[model samples]
Target: MKDFSDFFRNPHVWDREIVAVGGDLSSERLLYAYKNGIFPWSDQPILWYCLDPRGIFDLSKLHISKRVKRKINQKRYTITIDRAFEQVMRCCSHRPDEETWITELFIKGYTEFHKLGYAHSIEVWDEDGKLGGGVYGVAIGNFFAGESMFSFTPDFGKIGLFHLFEILKKDQFTLFDTQQLNIVTLGLGAYQISKKEYLRRLESAVGTGKKWTPPRVVF
Candidate 1:
């Protein structure tokens, strides 16, 4: 990892790696980064990015196991959209081990985006009507820029993800952006690709002239 100091002072550009600048970031800055194919990751203030190849899950290319399918069919939770987006963001921020930059400003900014019909959320509620798992992010046309997720129980992530997948599949979404690579998501079939390729797909999807029409209620 490069020092946060030199990064912002002089942004570096490499063939395989993308540019990374260092500095403070607000929610507005974060959204601007996403739209520009850059994101922030630092305890201090550094912007790091992997240029080559982006990670994505094409709706037509998703690989859901039969067991997971059965479990999803079980229908143990009530899935809702955007009704509790802020709650979903809080839940994702609550997970331990990582220092989250999801500040109060982020919550307010994303909430405003939700009101404008760009951001979305999938919330899973158990039989008792308590929140179990959730996922939230920005959706530009048919492409979903998934930010974070949280689960109160094992496999709740699967439930929340599958629920979102079902809707995207039906709606013919072009891509699902998981942002970065991790064992958990890799196991779920998310893989990495170059930023150029990611940008291409992103442009195509976002430029398709489709409007985001969130479900009246959770699907």
Candidate 2:
């Protein structure tokens, strides 16, 4: 395993070009880089970032609507963590006719992270155990970097998120970094801050060292 810190020591990966040397994506590498507040987003071959403010959700401050709450209470689906990670990522890849940085390389990397116990996923499965929707990302210390999510059914994505929130908040997470904010996320209680401000909060969150333990399985 390559030392991920080395990738950003030069910080060349964040340069955001389609260069050839960006190499492969793996969990060991992301786990190392995530601890340092860096992620690889590539359109083709090279990785780069927009270097703007980041959008985040304070786990302690999650705002769940009565509507979403009722939906969750209905228990229309079964939710679990770290199950069907690749499937969730693949579904998220084909979102709303949008082209994303998520690619074969992205799946390969996060999958590797999943195996390494650094990356985790939240899964929403129907009664038949077929995948409904889910989200995946890297968790280093107390900060969870929410990579992406998707839903084939209405509110599936939001339910998956709310379930994840219950676990993270119960475990005392300091923050949930959503990377970037979108209209959907704004409705889910996400807010934006400058990258510098993000780093400051990141520092505070990481230092707190929160531990998350999922709920006991009903089965």
Candidate 3:
């Protein structure tokens, strides 16, 4: 793996969102990038970004609508963590509308990260014992960077997000970086913060050395 430990030393990269380009998605590189609030957004040359307005979930203010709450109460789907990780990524990649950034390289890289215990997935299974949907991301210390989520059934992905929030809050995680905001995330109470504020929070969150342990099965 290339040594990107000093990749941010040039100060100039700080002002631009696309800080660097052209690097292999080695596990080491991914860890370093995420720890510093940078993430790869595109392939080909591999565009890495540290957006000025970073999207994040305010854990304390996560909104669970009554409808979603009722769905949770029904217990129609089973929730488990760090299960079906690669499958979750593949599901996220197969979006029907827009193009997806989850390339083959991303799958290979994040899967290796998952194997190393640095990445995780929250899976939702239907009553028939099939994958309905799930979310996946990387975790360093108390900070979790959610990469993507997908759903095959209505509100299935949201159920996974709710469970993920519970796990993070239970573990006393300090940061939940979503990277970009979408209507789904916005409805779930995601908001944007300046990069300056985000980096400050990221530094504190990463240095806390907190461990994330999955909760007991949620039915």
Per lDDT, the best of the predicted structures is 3
| Regions more than 4 Å wrong, model 1 | 1-32, 42-50, 65-67, 208-211
Scanning candidate 2 in windows of ten residues, the lowest lDDT window is 11-20
Query: Model 1: per-residue lDDT, tens digit, 118-202?
Result: 7888888888988888889877667788878888865666788887887887777777888777777887889887776887777
Error at 34, model 3, angstroms:
0.8
Give a tens-digit lDDT track for model 2, residues 1-219. 457543454322344322224656665556555555566777355563434567889776667788878988899798878767788888889856777888887888778877766677888887888888888887767788898988887777888888888777767777788877788888788998776676677777777333344553312
For model 1, the local distance difference test gives 0.70
Clashing pairs in 1: 51-195, 52-193, 52-194, 53-193, 53-194, 53-195, 54-193, 54-194, 80-218
Clashing pairs in 3: none
Candidate 1 weakest ten by summed lDDT:
1-10
By TM-score, the candidates rank as: 3, 2, 1
lDDT of model 2 at residue 114? 74
Question: Highest TM-score: which candidate?
Answer: 3
Of 1 and 2, which scores higher on lDDT?
2
User: Per-residue CA lDDT of candidate 3, range 74-103, in tens?
Assistant: 998789887788999999999788899999
Worst 10 residues of 3 by lDDT: 5-14
